[model samples]
Target: MPPKSKADGAKKARVPAKRKLAEEFPPGEVLTDNAKKKWKLGSAVGQGGFGLLYLDSSGSVGADAPYVIKVEPSDNGPLFSELKFYMRAAKPSLIGAWMNSRKIDYLGVPKYWGSGFHEKGGKRYRFMVMDRFGVDLQKKFEENGKKFPRKLVLQLGLRLLNILEYIHDHEYVHADIKASNLLLSYTNPNQVYLVDYGLAYRYSPEGVPKEYKEDPKRCHDGTIEFTSIDAHKGVAPSRRGDLEIMGYCMIQWLCGRLPWEDKLQDPLYVRDSKLRCRDNIDELLKSCFPSENLPEEMKKFMQEVKALEYTDKPNYAKLRGILLQGLKTIGATDDRKLDFGVSANDTGPPSIKVRATFSRTLKRRGRTLLASHNAVCIWKVPPGSWPMPAEGYLPTAVIVCNYRANLFNSAGSGW
Candidate 1:
């Protein structure tokens, strides 16, 4: 037998115990080297094993977006893990060509600011400065009655897929893709960001792919309901696993929950439930999408994802086409708006909400080129939208059509 690979060792990589955040840095503490003054901590906004995320007391850091400081003990938490990802994928120079090629201002990843060491009462701690984001999707989901608008679901899906493609191209896989890890811009609610790289791992290292073997001991490495089958088997995450997790997220977002969420404690059981669902998508979705049955297009998409191998480069365009097509079928627009709230009365033929039934088709298909092809189509006013030029309606549809669609253009600078 060939030398046993140490993939098993990944199973033993337990997170280090988190140190106390409050004990490390009290509110109003200013961290400085005097030689080059850094961040001053404000009130704590959030906490993680990495430490506390606080508003920047140093006015210098908050120019456009609010800057926040993260303080952590050098020995524990995800700050270091975050640092590695930023070093690789966030560097402007490193990703410049990649961004130019795609025509994206930024990869839906978090922005990295300055980082340094801070000492509080003889204890040394590391600190990083980064953009402060608004409420996360988990919070939004709960506030929206655990379900999001259909239009919102598709918009968020493509945004997330873009992030996945960018990260995957860079050799990393965000093993943990969940609501809580996604944040919105305080300045622009339309922009979605992927956060928390603590669980991210590179599927391919230095052009070599990790073997596809599973380790029973390493099963369940990500969120229970959303964890991929490979994760449940303790195998490293790959492109397929990322899409699998995203599929679960989309189902949960549209339906308000996944079939396996109730069994979160037993991750293995949840994983098994997901496997059962995948094996019988028709039945599972019959219960989940009862009105007209689940979108057949999505089922085919899942099949493609399930078919990918550990080393196979995902058919990025085909996978994205599935989502784009689904979005269009739902009458989703290129508009970045969540499409929530009660409809405003328009002079146009009363808003015709064309809800597609199983037999009636609203087909969609497209190129997955994020920068080149304008594949995302916003869910707009239905066919009944025939403005009589009566009410205060703009004659030009461009203004109201896809607000900020230009932001996704290939010629745009970072937004």
Candidate 2:
């Protein structure tokens, strides 16, 4: 028999010991960073697995605050994991230097502002300051009937290629890539930022790349739908893995769904589906885009991802070229504008938000049925048929769960 999942037991899965929920801090609470920079907090804007996010600004924190501060218990691991990547590679100077050298208009990576520790009521918390962002692409994706326009998808692919190349060059691999993790610029909707590095792994320490190795304990270490094949096999994330994940993101963004989305509760099943798709890229495309002309560029992109070895450095320029060519074929250019409007080719109207559900087993009418994982659809079940979070939940239309961090961050960034 297959191994029993966390939802198999009569009781719900217990929250891990180290996953401590953060206490909210009142507005105007002052925090002093190690650099002696004092940041005054606004109201708590968001919360994640083990952290609370507050608004901050040079003057008074308000709705227009330019920065957000993510605070977690000093003992939490997710924030610490993210801070290392930010400090090492996401510094504004580092990103600026790279942009200048590459001559690109802008990269999608988020800029790290500042980070330090704070003490409140004898409890220590870790905090990092970062630029505030606008709405996440996932929200936009849902609004557009769960599918992005073909041109927008290509533009996003090119932009993410720029981001993956930069982080890979810096020796870190962002193990997780999905719509929810991508947020638009607070001031410029055309500029998107990839955020939430809680699963970032330093595949290279110093200049040496880590050899390919799989650990069973590390299996399924990211968002199930978009995680790379390497991640499913328990392998440590690498450069190729980031590109693979990006490819999956683009496919889902354009096509609206994946073959294994309905089986996300079973990681093994999802992994197997991806393995089959990897062996036959054309079939995967045909299944997703049955009637429409196949996205030749997407097929080529998947082939490239399949050809990559565990340690091989991908030719990002070539991948970007493929997506650029795709845009051209569609009579579009990289105009740097993101259009979230409904596509003329969309099969149906956008899904109306009736009720959202989470991944868990529901005892309905004395029969156990597995609720779908992380989906936003018209829930057909009766009222009270679904489970709820212990502390209640937000009215988010869609929720993408991160397996590695067990985070519920929808405001688009820190966890």
Candidate 3:
């Protein structure tokens, strides 16, 4: 795909162009004039090392349109690093799994559109397009007066745990898991979507596969308050570290602040504080644990968290139940109105688009083969076309697809 040029705009007006199917395309990809004219960007939502996030109003509204656009400054190093992570690891590690597994309707992950670059003022900017949500968990907590109900916090923890479990099963770690990174889908308030996989990594036996690891001294990733103790100590991250940070975030969500928030001023301070806190771990745990007024399930959950040893932490599913119970209690009394603006009325077969970018050798097989190393494959499904199965899993027909050509034309071919 060629980068969108001014001439492409003229071509789109004459006929519906195939390349114009997406309002935006990545750098080197082309967009038709019709798409360029139709796609309108809304308010800037947030910004990070990756780029800026904007509310997008392009294509059709509701199920047919994309709701958010992430704009990356063309030549920014941090933004490029973030984009590379998304392009190579983040999208495929998580979104690819959901799409491949036919779990598009899963409640806690973002539905990604394609990514693209836009040139303005003679400078190129990279951006990723994804489904926009109503608000982030941090915003929701603030709206509730900066104090989330204990039950709701527990529910959020459970949902996040399930998402983590899924990611871990696929051999990846969401290194930057925090409240701000979690978004609530407008269609379902209870449904949480995990965004910003910029720091995500796939775990290798030799540890993070070399290519993804950044220098601990020069490159620090993750929020100060939510980062794990080991991470703060510049240790190579493991699944345990991810869960530990999650545990801390859960405490912050329920209590409105973390135990070390007042004591730590920076990552170094946080590291030292963790050592001191660990020396008196019982006292610190007591301060962070929920009060007696907390729900029974939540109280049990907190106890479990306190008892979590590096060698014997509980599995995510067990913790998930406790969190879900807590959230249900809080949601029952939640005064926020549920918004179901995006209706699933359209009746059509799910549109599946599979695109592959390969960097290694390809082997020929009679009619099937697995995705090779260093390969990026994308499969997109329009909403309302494929409903999640009653059992919560998508059908094989919906999940299986090929790395090349129409991968789904035949069934039972695993990637």
| TM-score top scorer | 2
Cα lDDT over the full model 1: 0.66
Candidate 3 runs further than 4 Å off: 1-50, 57-65, 88-105, 205-221, 266-268, 276-281, 289-314, 321-415
Q: Over the stretch 77-98, how does candidate 1's per-residue lDDT look in tens digits?
A: 5787777777677665655667
lDDT of 3 at 174: 75
> What is the lDDT of every predicted structure here?
0.66, 0.78, 0.51
lDDT (10s digit) by residue, model 3, range 153-216: 5556656776776666555677767766788876667678787765565554333332324345
Rank order (by lDDT, best first): 2, 1, 3
Please state every model's RMSD to the true fold in angstroms. 13.0, 14.2, 22.4
Pull out the clashing pairs in model 1. 218-234, 331-379, 332-378, 332-379, 333-377, 333-378, 333-379, 334-377, 334-378
Residue-pair clashes per prediction, in order, are 9, 0, 10
- Among all candidates shown, the one with the greatest lDDT: 2
TM-score of 3: 0.58
TM-score, cand. 1 vs. native:
0.75
Query: Of 1 and 3, which scores higher on lDDT?
Result: 1
Q: In candidate 2, what are the lDDT values of residues 59-103, reduced to their tens digit?
A: 788889999999999988878889999999999999999999999
